[model samples]
Target: MTGNGADRKTALVISAHAADFVWRCGGAIALHQARGYEVTVACLSFGERGESAKLWKQEGMTLEAVKSARRNEAEAAAKALDVHDIRFFDLGDYPLEMDRDAKFRLVDLIRAVQPNFMFSHSRFDPYNTDHMYATQIALETRMIAQAWGHNPSEKVLGAPQLYLFEPHQTEQMGWRPDVFLDISEVWDKKRAAIECMQGQEHLWTYYTNVAENRGNHFRRNSGGMAGGRPARYAEGFETVFPRTVDELG
Candidate 1:
């Protein structure tokens, strides 16, 4: 708030579950926060139903216990990146369908935050129905935010940039990321940030591998990996609403 105005340019990361952003766009979030960007993390659910039993067995983790544990973990991770706003929607764990009211709430949040950039999982993720539903929520929220007369209040809230974070889809999902943000400098912070997910049992490693692979892909595109490299370690994103056709075309 002191260094840079939080209201100016904000980033909102909306994930289906507690650890989705940690496993995918942790580095990107850290990088944005380091650059004085206001960051908000919104978890649709605490993933209570999916948390590793082998890890939380010692805590006698129930649904409430798991949700509390995940909240603390998410707070720690967001704090590591200097994120100010961390919210959880608590819309159940596995099934994240958008009942009309839920979509309106999401639209209201988009209108209130007015994030310049948004990060969410792809709609094509087949492994998790929640991810696809979350993506749907993001898309519908974007539409609602921009719909004039329809949402009288949101008419003032202009359309914000939206980016779909990479899903855990290597072969079947067919996700092609069109935007990549260099996060090499924040990689360590990203690793440190994700370690806070105690319920995850070192889930950072999977993302680290993804980052490394993306880094190599970055190198291949830029002709180098480090030292004045064009975005070595990064997170890849696809635009849900394509505003610019110059490059995309």
Candidate 2:
């Protein structure tokens, strides 16, 4: 929306934890990168205390050690997906509180990326308050990015779609995804990225099944038993904001 040509096609993923993007929207990231779009992932935390239970079971594991391990895995996963950039805020999880400065920092990233669309966690996650908190931060930063008075020297952000990606235990989270992306083309890349989350090996299979089930939904929604795209793997997302179009389907 900011410019023309391939360089203008950009996307931002605001993840609550190091591996959230990998599990939720890894295929979208890889597929977008494959289609000449630069996708940047921003992780607020390394999920050291809350999401790194396996690593904590180690004999002599420390907080820094767990954080380092998660960071390494995220970097490798980003590499596998050919991500344009991956940033770690090191904001420590469990509560995942953000001060005014932290929110401003994210606003800066939003303006810099100037993404055509953005991805973040679900709005409500009782199981993981950190996930919902990340979504709140995503919405706040996006609004700040669009304000002219926030940083008059830089270009204000345009209206980019903020997509709320699906969450674990989604049934209880009230996350209804209206968008289904076919990631069959990049399923291998997604799987490779999923495998990189060595600390959270338990979730790897669960997410794989999620992709497969979402693929079925994609096919059915597109037109099942008639003329549907054969998507073997997919990801679902719920849109946070509405769009303004000249025409509607």
Candidate 3:
């Protein structure tokens, strides 16, 4: 509600699974939230089927139980990141799909938030089609939101940059980074959020390593030998649209 205010800056993240946002762009979410931006996360699924291997191994695990556990973890992580809002589509995973009605719901949300910019998964992911499908949903919904005839009464959505977060296997996913965000200040918050994903304990150290590596990249790109922002942690992104700038510097 507050994010819709004309003066407020807002961002939307379309996560394919419960922990995708946590593992991918938690730093960006935390940093931007700290900088007075209301960040909203839309999780397409709890990753109950494919991604809940740890939970499934626990002796007694049902679909509903897994979903509950995953949702709780997601909420905890969102709280750690100070997320303004979090929505769950509960559309199922392993092959996330959305019909016309579901898509319209997302388009409505996009209209309500009217985010300054949006975040989603890389365009292509061979390992996980769900990740790529979520990005497709984001793009389609964004376009639908801009259509004047879709919802004639509501305000037409403005063009917002869709930033694709770094995927797990960059080498195989063909994801290239065109932007690096310095999240040194909110690294602690992002780490705290990452810890909330108790289901995926194995990834705790891996994503931490990712931030550290990206921080090095940030330092190098910021000024290489000349001296850059001494960023201790960072996140990488690939913009789907061109950025309009008044000056190069």
Q: Write the per-residue lDDT of candidate 2 for residues 1-249, one digit (tens) a residue.
A: 333245469999999999999999999999999998999999999999999999999999999999999999999999999999999998889989899998999998888889999999999999999999999999989998989899899988888898999999999999999999999999999999999999999998999999999999999999899988889899999997887777888
Q: How accurate locally, in lDDT, is each candidate?
A: 0.75, 0.93, 0.93
The residue-by-residue lDDT of candidate 1 on 1-249, one tens digit each, is 111134477778888888888777888788877777778888888877865564457655566777787888888888876776888888876667668887777777777777777888876867887887887888777777777865784434555667778887656676788767778888878887778887776556777878888886776666553443655477788876657444552
Q: Candidate 3's C-alpha lDDT?
A: 0.93
What's the lDDT for residue 119 in model 1? 86
**Candidate 1 error regions (>4 Å):** 1-7, 55-59, 224-232, 245-249
Candidate 1 deviates by what RMSD?
3.8
Predicted structure 2: lDDT: 0.93
**Each prediction's TM-score versus the true structure:** 0.87, 0.97, 0.97
Local lDDT at 87 for model 1 = 84
Question: Which ranges in model 2 have alpha carbons more than 4 Å from their true place?
Answer: 1-6
